[model samples]
Target: MISTYRAVVLTRNGGLDALELRELPLEAPGPGQVRLRVRATGVGFTDIIMRRGYHPDAPKLPFTPGYEVVGDVEAIGPGVTGFTPGQRVAALTVHGGYAESIIRDAGEFIPVPEGLDDAEVTALILNYVTAYQMIHRVARLRAGQSALVTGAGGGVGTALLQLLRVAGVQAYGVDSPPKAGLVRELGATFIDSRERPFDEAVRKRLPEGVDVAFDGIGGDSIARCTRAVRRGGRLISYGFTSAVGRHGGGDNVGGLSGLLALFVGTRLLGRRPSVYGITQLYQKDPSLLREDLSQLFTLLAERRIQPLIAHRLPLLAGRAGQELLERGGIRGKIILLRDVPKKT
Candidate 1:
């Protein structure tokens, strides 16, 4: 068996330089665990926050930063059943996925159907599932209802538009001028928040407001989203990009406290305030993630949804992939494919 593998470790909280590509020792899978030969992992803004040492959920420095990965089973520990070597699987690792191999609890992974692209599958594990659960489970939006999606053209934002279109929901997507075309292409009415504030743009188009609004760009963006929501409509705050600064250099505590204050203030206005964190929800019930992800896999199989991949970089380019995501202007997800060798 292989003894060591390459991984991108966050040596210290800082800029892109903090991520170091190094060879790390590998260990045998412990009981109830499986070692995965990672095929692809996703690079997201959450990883950016974690890298900057601002994310409250981040582990100590000098750890991996990947949140989700798709891989083939390399080995299985004793007491783990129903999994054989070479089986492709996906997991919500939340860390340790920016490596060539990872040993995780068997229960953390679900069997991935054959024929699906590994990079696309990695996108679904976090982006699509979050979109799916927020729309169906949290917002519980039904067909024909109108909703607003902020940060449209982002990983989760694009996922929301695609899934909303599939569900027959009318979507108004708020984004920058660059992403307007992509958002509209996904069957959403595009609102360029950069041209005008998203709340004003949404309200101008939807005088009565929308049935629901999904805002991932937190901070004052939360309150802006609530304004676009109808009296009885709900606003779901899923992320805090602004709070943490898209490229870092933001205050974590201030951002979170401000988020809570907005929730309370929005509630006082008689608007239903809600929040959705895929990790937190998954922790409450792992089966929900399994079920939702299974459905997403089927959706991909049927070609009902497509994960827009902005860039496919080699595993060692994890830091570069994240830099692209942070710089923005990309329409969709950035994937780190382990099978692709980094250019020398």
Candidate 2:
């Protein structure tokens, strides 16, 4: 019965002003598709990168910018079975999630188990999956080994810390002093990036370096991480957040080209350097995403890991949420909800 829905549209890459909330016509699901009433969507540094025209995977201008969403199937198109009206589901939207309703291929969404909070489930879709894949599939780190995690208090960073503990890998987390307690509480040895260079501080404690290191800060942070790993160990560079701050956090950062250059530099040093993008990997193997996400859901249900949710903002507040994320110091994922559930 809804005739229109709201979504955040990125008119062009620039500052927070580029993000605009617009009402769009509602369209029924086409064959093989489902129309969902969105419950929650996640916003992170990636959204900031896209807003500043620095994410390689971002779509053309005048597009939505949400990466993941949890919703209820309000309508199902013909040829779609398995999903019924009112069924709860989640999807790795990649874009088009900052909305009240959206239509996408039914295959794009996976059923979300009941009793899990919508915001928490939204957090798992992107951040947790990225962390899970990097540690297990990419690094193949084993128990008793050691690793270092940079940006240890952000969404993916916190997820990485908790998962590293579950894998029984000793972890060293680098962050500002303000976040030391949160990092340490997650069972990681905290290294203050302010005391000195992180790699030097890490070497002071671990003379031989760790078994592996994960760097999402990119830029010069990548080189430091390469040194933090043992001679034969590996370094996985996933994001380029540090670049955002260099030009006032609003100017375009060179996207993947810059990140790749850093990786090549590290590789030239005889250390293994790898880069990861959740959307790129999911596009290649959709089933892998399903399998991994299902495992993460189980872990959440069993309370093996708790996702840190720093802020939950209203749907239309997408711009404000991204601004807060840009300011940094947020300890976890920021979720945008169509409507906040009232406390009982």
Candidate 3:
């Protein structure tokens, strides 16, 4: 008899209902692939877009939507080394992560650092690594600098805020009113985005201008990031949770118009400021994606960065996570399937 494992497969796209938890044959890792017994999976905004069939870069239909996973290696394919069976690990596979078992190249998996729980480490992988790479590698933030983060209390936003605070830089986080405390807890000043304009909100925190702006809101939110920065400051536009499948990419919602606006604004201005969509690390060095994962795992060992728990849901109830993230009530990461492993 074939062994079966549960997986949330996106055979097609539309709503959270598209994610069907069903049985699949559990197979051994192919060459250089590591087979993981998934312990926890993070529900990110990207997954939200992919589930909606929007994100232009999202995988073709009938593919899994999960971007990252935290789990233990149960098997390895030929030529795979540096990891053994039963070793705790986390990976940024970009797909196939929403399953009880997943296979990916060995280079993509990072061993979970000592003293960290699988749930916490899984929560930290993609969002924290993406934020860390942009802030440290791309922005090269300096001490005493100021920064603005849109969606400030979300996974990426919280990570950015925390990193800036640790570097001795002031951070302004734009989030909903209920998340205000969580944003402030990350050592950032919080602004309730629903009630105030982002520029005015951030200005109240930094009367001058901010030095760097990390924007994920991707609609007119880019304009807010624009207004917050001082002359010569850099703006990193990455996510478009609001514009997910729309704008510069294709049909959907918020679109990349926010990004286009930044580019246009740069051209209209005298050219002192630089506005570029992020994906910089991915463009420059894809290997850095894995390296960033490694670095965060190291930080986790030392408690330099911590995971914020918003809510935990079952892998089958991904819609709950999607709703929490979409509603914007949660400040930290939402982890799915706390105790259940997809594979036995």
TM-scores, in order shown? 0.96, 0.95, 0.89
Model 2 residue 66 CA deviation (Å) reads 0.6
| Candidate 2 per-residue lDDT over residues 168-251, each given as its tens digit | 999999999999999999999999988899989889999998988888877678878877888878998788776676336532
On lDDT, the leading prediction is 1
- A best-first ranking of the candidates according to their TM-score comes to 1, 2, 3
* Two-way TM-score contest, 1 vs 2, winner: 1
Q: Which pairs of residues collide in candidate 2?
A: none
Among these predictions, the greatest TM-score belongs to 1
**Model 3 per-residue lDDT at 105:** 79
lDDT of 3 at 261: 64
233-274 per-residue lDDT for model 3 (tens digits)? 777877666665322234343454665667877445422334
Model 3 Cα displacement at 265 (Å)? Answer: 0.7
Model 3 weakest 10-residue run by lDDT: 270-279
On a 0 to 1 TM-score scale, where does candidate 1 land against the true structure? 0.96
Provide the overall lDDT of each model, using Cα atoms, as 2-decimal numbers. Answer: 0.89, 0.88, 0.75
Candidate 3 residue runs with Cα over 4 Å from true position: 204-207, 245-256, 270-284, 338-344
